[model samples]
Target: MTPTSALLSTRPWPLLLLLTLLLPGLVQAQQPTAVIAARATLSSWSDPLESLGTLRADESVTLSATVTDIVRELNFRDGDTVEAGRLLVRLADDEAQADLRAAQALRDERRNAVNRLAQLQSRNLAPRADVEDARAQLRQVEAEIQALEARLADYRIQAPFDGRVGFRNVSLGTLVTPGTELVTLDKLDVMKLDFTLPEVVLGQLAEGLSLTATSPAFPNAVFAGEIASIGSRVDPVSRSVTVRAELDNPELRLRPGMLMNVVVQRAPRNALVIPESALIPQGQRQYVLVLDEDDDYRVARREIGIGARRAGEVEVLEGLAEHDLVVAHGTERVRDGQTTRLLGILDDDTSIPELLRRGRDQAEANG
Candidate 1:
């Protein structure tokens, strides 16, 4: 009390009052701030066209019985990989087999008659008409046998191509008729993806161009493929063209009807690239707080022109130069020409874009 009162008593009352008011602001200005940052760099950027697509099997079909019969055997299980011509299902073929046998016996008997008649004709004992009639009977019996054999083939269901079989709808001993679906077969070694894009970009698209695709089923995996075909005409209503690409799926992980996100790179050019998180959009203008060139710890707001974005990076068309530092995080806490101490420079591998994505993933997991 004595020291504080002595100092206060010697100072003017106005001076003491003024000092008390300034102390809080001085302390606030000196407080340390923690934030993440990145440098604007000169790099080549491609306008990556993104679109939603559907994955389809290279070949697919619903295996169905061609004729009405009771199922005798099912040689495949649900989701089994099979080769072309592999026997899939067998129907009760007893009646078909009996018919074939009867046809064969009749043909054999007719052949014997034809031989006897031919011998008689050579000896001039039987008329030539008799030999001709026997020969015609033999030919008719052979035709009946051929028809029965063809009908017999319908009882055995075989795979049309190499593929994976889906769940069976009809089990052994189940009565099935023609056009009844038994199972589904899909060739998954390669997948076809169909997507649509604006007709304006059609001139840039061509066959054999490489593309990448990602699916929600396997978020961490990326599948690479190439453009297999392009649409011949653009849709008048949507003014878009349908594109089809083929992806090699050696692991057979991708299945038909799965939705995928596709990225197609087009028109590469050199530009100033920055983390997409650094752009601060306000009203109709965009801004970035760039570190001051003279004072590395200070930042100043600058309006920027932006172009196409891909991954976690955005193309800076103007108002920024290579090698300029920009505050990527904690922008709301910063002001133009304010002093800021960067926690540390962003790691080359840990860009702000990737970090933001990780943050979003964590939030989703937590929820």
Candidate 2:
């Protein structure tokens, strides 16, 4: 007998055990590995520019008294919303009111005298000079009444615009004078966000560019706004330009002097994007398994240049094209030139188990 046959016969059980182990490996090597893949798609991508910003009211003012007097009537409380021309405070105007009434009564008497003089002069009983003098006296009294009315106005304080008032600085019976801050008023229906950006990006900035802002106070809420104005001149010291954005504050959630994080959204352009899971990092290099449908769905390892990433997606700058299928799951079981069974295309919501179950059901129905 041949030497090989003799050895095999002497160790028959050992040979059988080796064959049993080798048979499954050979079968497994030939079977296609099931994998879920995603197609690289052209999607809108915006390069976001981030910076710190401060929130400001659309209009703000410090309300104060215009004259020195004791506070008589307090028309507004702390944090009261008022409209334009709303009465807010009335100083002690008793003396001014009394003077106005006296002047008005004197004006009435002078007018009656002028009328009576004119009636007599028409009959040639009164001289024309006397009639003219009476008319002049009436005009003088009317001017005095006007002066007193203006004086009374200075004793009252009214809102200049529609806004919300801050805490009261003066209380009832408190004596106040010109420039004494009584309160603060701010238009809170719309808020202004001011931030600075490097002048290098001035070419890309324009009024009406959309942006988003966020505050630590509201973790989950995102506020939307648009650029309202750009600073006319760049700041020489910082080499940056101030940008103002307007945000509607219908809920009054944004307040003045609040710190916010701003993200300026530049123009969007179409870019090739794939699922982030498709990336395989190898020593600072990113690689992905691209499926070749023309070659029996064989996978080819390709190096790709990556750019910005957001959520579960990544921007592929190179080595990928629109509609190119890449393995998104089960990448570990794949190799170059290895045939793979495509379960389905993956999306933002689908899972690997769901794709496997779908593939199995299809196979069963076909069988």
Candidate 3:
């Protein structure tokens, strides 16, 4: 300082200018850098198995007629919800109706004859053989009537179960024969999702396991379901087993033949978790900046072992503890032993950009 002070004294204006320029930097160095941090939390984590699946109605059937007849009346409109035994279509049955009436007339005549013969036999005026013959004739007429009724039933179409009907395939006066497609019916109260998983995970497949599904048609909606059954046999070529899950479709938003993404969660366990942004890859290792609150909030670089990652969260297998705060944002600008000002805490629900914006607003308000 002896020689330097003499020089500085001679040129005090230059020294003052240097101090003026360096003072701001000195102040900035003393101040801590702002960073967004998050605490390592113990949370329930599960390994997810993802696969493509197709959605089908819980119960689906094609409604058809069994006898050739003209559609005399259409009892249901397109897309109508029908109940079991509800008649959806009525075919022309005038001819059958006439035949049934004639059979009924004959049945009544036979019954009267049997009664008359019984009365005469009771009074010893008719032979027992004649009474038996009348009784046999009455039974034969009754059998014929039953057969005609059954044949008449085939001319009408009824819903076998409660379900929604598809578009009208046949209209009034359209003649339909046996096995002719009338309309499609599907039970849509519950949907069935079928997917295949590799045989390796067959052990994890079980009835009643919870799963989630999403379809492109409803981007924001998530469908929850449970495994209903596991296929009895595995596919030999694909080495996969089919799994069927049942989803409640109270709103009727899901339809048959919809492609969906399925995720099956398995092996749930408690683990230390941190935001994925905190991980910094160094060569083959993952590192994070952990804050030492006791040492004036200084940050230290730490190597951590990572396991499964999910939804922007990393499962910490080692080198972290519960409640250990780690630098989540502005990590690139920070160095070892550097103190950091916690702008905000990052959570699963809070994002990094949101925290940074909040931090900036807070800083502006403070200023």
- For residues 1-367, what per-residue lDDT tens digits would candidate 2 score against the true structure? 9999998788978888999999989997888998999999999887888999999999999878888999999898888889999989889998888888888899889889999999999999999999999999889988998888888888878898999999987778898989999889999999999999999999999898889999999999999999999999999999999999999999888899999999998866788999899999999899999999898789999999999998788999999989999999989998999999989898768887899899989989986
Candidate 3 lDDT over residue span 1-367, tens digit each = 6998888778978888999999999997888999989999999888989999998998999978898889998888888899999988889999999999999999999999999999999999999999999999999999999999999998878999999999997888898899999889999999999999999999977788888999989999999998999999999999999999999999999999999999987776899999899999999999999999888679999999999999889999999999999998889989998988988888758877898899889888987
Q: Which has the better TM-score: candidate 2, or candidate 3?
A: 3
Residue 96 accuracy (lDDT) in model 2:
86
| lDDT-better candidate, 1 vs 2 | 2
The CA-based lDDT of model 3 is what?
A: 0.92
Tell me which residue pairs clash in candidate 2. none
User: In model 1, which runs have C-alpha deviations exceeding 4 angstroms?
Assistant: 1-45, 268-367
Model 1, position 245, has a per-residue lDDT of: 98
Please give the range of 10 consecutive residues that has the lowest summed lDDT in model 3: 343-352
* Prediction-by-prediction clash tally: 0, 0, 0
The whole-model lDDT of each prediction reads: 0.88, 0.91, 0.92
What candidate 3 gets wrong by more than 4 Å, as runs, is: 1-17, 112-136, 292-295, 335-337
Which structure is stronger by TM-score: 1 or 2? 2
C-alpha lDDT of residue 84 in model 1: 99
Candidate 1 lDDT over residue span 1-367, tens digit each = 6999999787898787998999999996787554578889988767788899998999999878889989999999889999999999999999999989988999999999999999999999999999999999999999999999989999988999999999988878999988999889999999999999999999999898778999889989999998999989899999999999999999999999999999986775688888888999998888999886477578789999999887778889899988888998978888887877665456576755566666567658966
Error of model 1, residue 339, in angstroms: 25
